[model samples]
Target: MIKNYRMVLEYDGSRYDGWQKQGNTEQTIQGKIEQVLERMTGQAVEVHGSGRTDAGVHALAQVANFHMDGKMASKEIQEYLNQYLPEDIRVITLEPAKERFHSRLNAQEKTYLYRIEMGERKQVFERKYIYGLYKSLNVEAMERASAYLTGEHDFKSFCSNRKMKKSTVRVLKEIEFEQQGSRLLIRYTGNGFLYNMVRIITGTLIEVGLGQRKAEDMKGILEAKDRNQAGFTAPPEGLFLEQVRYNV
Candidate 1:
């Protein structure tokens, strides 16, 4: 009988292209897992991810699902995947799922984290995971700017895809910030996000923190609905797919 399985994955995406498989490359998170599953089952296997992360982005609790013909214990399958997959990527958990369950279509919420190092010192081991800025950012100003971003809005200005036909509206539930000495962590929870939306919003907030832009300007930018009205897109190294939430 064909059985369906769900798995939570964690990957250091620095070395991979992204989460999705592309025709041009096999060095993607989804492609790697699919390859291992195909080898194990001796048939083609397709893995579906909750969402796609950009190049060099990381993930802590990405969810995925796949179907296979044979039966195998979840522990054995996890172990096999961990053994064959690269050290940077690992399956955190695996279990049986409903036949109709899908990682993407069933996802309700996603939280992304962006790490910023606000100091002149260079990162040693964490260089590939953090974005470094040589100056301090005003946390208070950033918080004020974030208020305007919360709630449902058409975030067309923040998206990178110029020709996107799908709706650009998304419900950004929250934007929380934490500061630990020189490290600043920003977490964004949303029902859905447009292409490069988080990065662009981060860049806009950084500008507000730097006094390059005012917090109140966010409303105007949102109304403009033009990508050029938004700030630059932040680097992908600092972004991570922190978590995905489902109703269960």
Candidate 2:
């Protein structure tokens, strides 16, 4: 009998092309996970993820599901999978899930984090994980700008140029910024995200922090609904899929 299971995964996606497979040219996180599963189970399994993160983005709590034969315990699968998987990718937790559970379709909310380093000295160890912005940022300005992004809005200005099937509207539950020493973290939780949404938002927020854009300008940007009205999209290396929530 085939059983469905969910796994929580964490990966440093700097080397991969993204979370989804694209033709034969690019290395993707999903493709890597499928390859590991195939090697362990001696069968091909399709893995579904909560969302497709962009290239160079990381994930701390990405959820995915796959079907496998027999009733093997989740712990056994987790242990063996970790042993064979590459160092950058790991299965943090595993559990049997409902047959109808689908990682992408069943997800209710997602939280993403964008990290940046301020000041002169850059941390050599975190160069791959965080974007280094040498200029000083106004945290209060960023907070005020972030407030404008909360609530339901058509975020077309923040979306990438790629085609999207769903509407650009998203409900932002929270948008916050915090500083810890040289690290600045921007956290966003929302019902859904469009392609490069978080990165674009971060870019716009950075503009506000630098005084290039005013906090109130975010409203006009939303109203314009034009991609050109927003700031440039930030680099993917600083972004991370922090968490995914599902209905229990």
Candidate 3:
């Protein structure tokens, strides 16, 4: 009997090439997990992630699933995988999932966080994870600009034009910015996001904060729906997939 298992994972993306398995290259998070599973079960297995995090993007709770004929207890499977997998990747939770549950398709909501440090002194320990900016930003203007980004809208202006598989209309549920001295944290909760959406949004807001653009300009950018209308995409290291919510 084939049994499906769900896993909640956390990983530091500094040394890995995102979550998807690339052709034969073992540097990806998915590739590392698949290799360890293949070695443990002595059969080729595939793991599906909730979503693809770009290279250098971190994850706090990435969901994934795999099916196997061998029936092992959830604890045993978790322990076995963790024992062999690299130190950076960790399986935080494991359990049986409904046979039809898909990590990506069944997801209801996703949360992402972008970290920025604005000061003369670089964040010594968090230099790799957070973005460092030297200039002071007008936080109130950025917050005013964020209000325009909420609600359902075509976000093509904020997404990468490289390759898009579906419609760019997405519901941006909420955007919150928290400030603590020289550190700023931007959190996004949404139904879905297009390629490079969060990063682009951050860049546009930063432009507003810099007095380069007015807060009301966000409406024009959204209406334009042209990638060229948006600001630059932020660095990958500042992004983190915080959670994936499911109905089940």
The local distance difference test score of each candidate is 0.94, 0.91, 0.92
**Candidate 3 runs further than 4 Å off:** 162-165
Please, what is the TM-score per model? Answer: 0.98, 0.96, 0.96
Root-mean-square deviation of Cα positions for candidate 1 versus the true structure, in angstroms: 0.8
Residue 123 of model 2 has an lDDT of: 81
Best by TM-score: 1
Candidate 1 error regions (>4 Å): none
lDDT of 2 by residue, 42-80 (tens): 889999999999889999999999999856778988988
**Tell me, what's the RMSD of every candidate?**
0.8, 1.2, 1.2
lDDT of 1 at 100: 91
**Residue 129 in candidate 1 has what lDDT?**
89
Better of 2 and 3 by lDDT: 3
Least accurate stretch of 10 residues (summed lDDT) in model 1? 67-76
Model 3 agreement with the true structure over 1-248: per-residue lDDT tens digits: 88998999999999888889888667999999999889888898899999999889999999999998747789999999999999989999999999999999999999999988888867688888998876788999999999999999999899896466689999999999999889889999999988889999999999999999999999999999889999989989899999899998
